[model samples]
Target: MSIAKKLVGQTAAYGLSSIIGRVLNYLLVPVYTKAFLPEAYGVVTYLYSFVALFNVLYTYGMETAFFRFANKPGTDQRELYNKVLSLIGSSSLIFTAILLLASGPIANFIGFPERQEYIVWLAIVLAIDAIATIPFAWLRLQNKAVKFASIKLINIVLTVGANMFFLVFCRQVYNGDYLPELRPWVTSIYNPDFGVGYIFLINLVANALQLPLLWKELSIFRFRLDVDQLKPMLRYAYPLLFMGLAGMVNEVIDRILLEYHLPDNFYPNMSNMAAVGIYGACYKLSIFMSLAIQAFRYAAEPFFFSQANDKNSPQAFAQIMKWFVISCAFIFLFVSAFRDEIASVFIDESYHSGLVVVPILLLANLFLGVYYNLSVWFKLTDRTQFGTWISVGGAVVTIMLNLLLIPVLGYVGSAWATLCCYFAMAAVSYFLGQRYYPIPYPVRSIIGYIVLAVVLLLGVFYVPVQQVWLNYLIGLVVCALFLVIVAARERLLFFNK
Candidate 1:
């Protein structure tokens, strides 16, 4: 099979799992928004922001390093895997232990003194998740897409089901809404005071469940730390650790910043935390773009490494970049065009005020996807320091803009900062990729499609028609126009090949 076709197949498998699983997971948004006030929901948002940052720390780019070293000629893949898992596993235990000992102080520091258990729960979740990374990456390296997808789907399903059982079934029974006879059983397990804490606890349980599910992969793991093998891998990966941290700052620091930096009463009748909650809820609307990026990343990472030695790799990369841009543009246009309807379906009405950021975030994530595609240059050429620098630059932009803009424009400022950061990162990465390890990406065509999508989306938003049906019809027509144009331009690329 052609490289493009193979990638498409693997990406489709991964996408099926990611997109479907996340959609199910996202259903919790409405449940949470309805169950807890915005102020309460904001706690979930805030804590998870920290989780995203620490997750990068726990894995520390070793997954990619595993991929890099394992693919090297004459390397013992099994021994390399053992060393990588052992390093991460031992460190994860130490990290979790420290967190457990300090959970009380950390809870006090975060203003959650009463909920110190949250820290303990998340620490375990982090460790389990960190340990599981190599196993998951191993599955990818072995091209076990089906198994990977199945495990991922099962995790999501279990998480969603556990959430419903606790938040919906237990709460309803405890409140006497239904199943009054089961109130005794529900009362035994459910504590109303736990509130949003159940979200964290459920996640801990779900992640713990993954250990047994991945036993087949984990069975081969034996604790061994080969310093000779470890030093070079660390050299390649430590930069990625910083890069991933900075990249996460670009992705999630806004939520954290919005919580503290947003001015009092900026949204009228809303606390700063409530505004953060609303922003978090509305951000889910951008998952369409994120889903595409994540699926592509899953399949593209290993594929890129495998193809690095190919003579025609540059052309293959260009083709992948073009299609990736096209796919993301469509997601941006579609989601932004129907932003209101989608928000209403998935987010509660109380959280609808922050929906304005959806389009901005969608566009930002589109640029993020492009940056991911462009980043293959640095990864393949082993110039990972360049990746670190670009990400740090992006993080600086994110931090500065959040500090300067949040006070002035509220969460809207944070949204604008995200867009600016990702665009800058993508532009910088593209230029640097050209100078360092050039991939002949279809630059003009990529930009043209993005511009066209933006224009059409704008037209959908600014149409004079006041009728709902008319607006939707206009959206469909414009979307169809985009598809037609793309099909005409790329006719020979897919079908002929």
Candidate 2:
């Protein structure tokens, strides 16, 4: 089978599970916004952004190491799996215990002194998630996409279901006159003061429950550590650990910064927390692009490692990168064209103010996706420190730009910061990747498609179509035309007529 075919097949399986599953999960954005005020929603967004950072810290790049080391010829996969699991499990327990012990001080430090249990609950979920990271990576290594997708979807379903039950059903039971008998029972569990805390609480239950379901992946390993293999794996992954933290900074530091940089007085009657809530909701409008890139990474990472020795792998990577760029460009245009529609529905109208940044964030994520493709070079060559340096560069830019801009332009500044950061990261990664790994990516064709997409996007932005249907029609036609042009240029469409 062609590598393209195999890649598409794997990407489809992963996409179905991750992209579709995440979109389904993303539906909760509306549920959350409807349930919690923007200030409360801001708190949820704030804590979860920290969670993303901490998650990277807890996993410490071990998952990628598992993929690389477990695939080595003559290596015992079972033994490697056991060690990886042991390392993550023990570290997660220690991390969780420490956090739980100091939950109060940490909560107070973060200005959430009253919600000390929030820290404790988050620690529990984080520990479970940290430990589960290895087993999930093990499944991906084994090419168990079906199982992977199933387990991921199950977790999503559980989380979403719990969220709806608590936020919707419980609210109905508590507020409605029909449930007179059940009102007190529902009211007992539902605290208006708890607000968005229930969101995290539901996630905790979901994360905890999903671990037991991953017993197949976890059950094989006893609690024994392999010191020798552990050392090399740590050596390999520690650099990636820094890369992960820096990369996360590039990804989510805006959310974190929006809360701190934009104070209550930043805007008349607009709390920084509310701005964050609005920014977080509007950010969800770009999930179409994020979901695609995430699904691609899920399939691509393992696929890249497996094909490391193939003589044609470089050519294949170039081809894959082209398709990825074109696909991401299509998503960018699709979402940008209907940005208002998605934002309007993604959450309440209160979030509509931040919708203007959707296009910027979408384009930023496109660059980030390209960066992900370029990153394969460092990972494949074990030059993982390059990854760390690149991410740190991006992180520095993210911080500097956010610090300089947020007070002036608000979240829009953060959006521009993200776009600039990813563009710089992609450019740097490509320059270094060519020198180090030297994949023959089709530069001209890729540039042509990108230029075309951006032209269309700019045209649409400047020339607003009053009719919604007309706007969508134009977007679809442009998207179709781009695909046709790509196929004709590559001779996949119209052929030797």
lDDT string for model 2 (1-497, tens) is 27766888899998888886888889899898888888889888889899999999899999999999988999999888888889889899999999999999999998899999899999999999998888888888888889888989999998889888888888777778466789888888887667778888888998888888898877787777867858999999999999999999998899989988875687667889899889988888889998889888988999999999999888888888888888888888878987877777778887788888998999999999999999999999999999999999999999999999998999999999999999999999999999999999888877788888889888777776898788778877877887777777778622111
- TM-score for all predictions? 0.98, 0.96
Best by TM-score: 1
Total backbone collisions for each predicted model: 0, 0
Each model's lDDT: 0.91, 0.88
What C-alpha root-mean-square deviation, in Å, does candidate 2 show against the real structure?
2.1
lDDT of 1 by residue, 152-251 (tens): 9999999999889899889889999997899999899999888998899889989898889899999988889776869999999999999999999998
What lDDT does candidate 2 reach at residue 28?
95
How much is 4 displaced in model 2, in angstroms?
A: 2.1
lDDT: worst 10-residue window of model 2? 488-497
TM-score quality measure for candidate 2: 0.96
Residue 417 of model 2 has an lDDT of 99
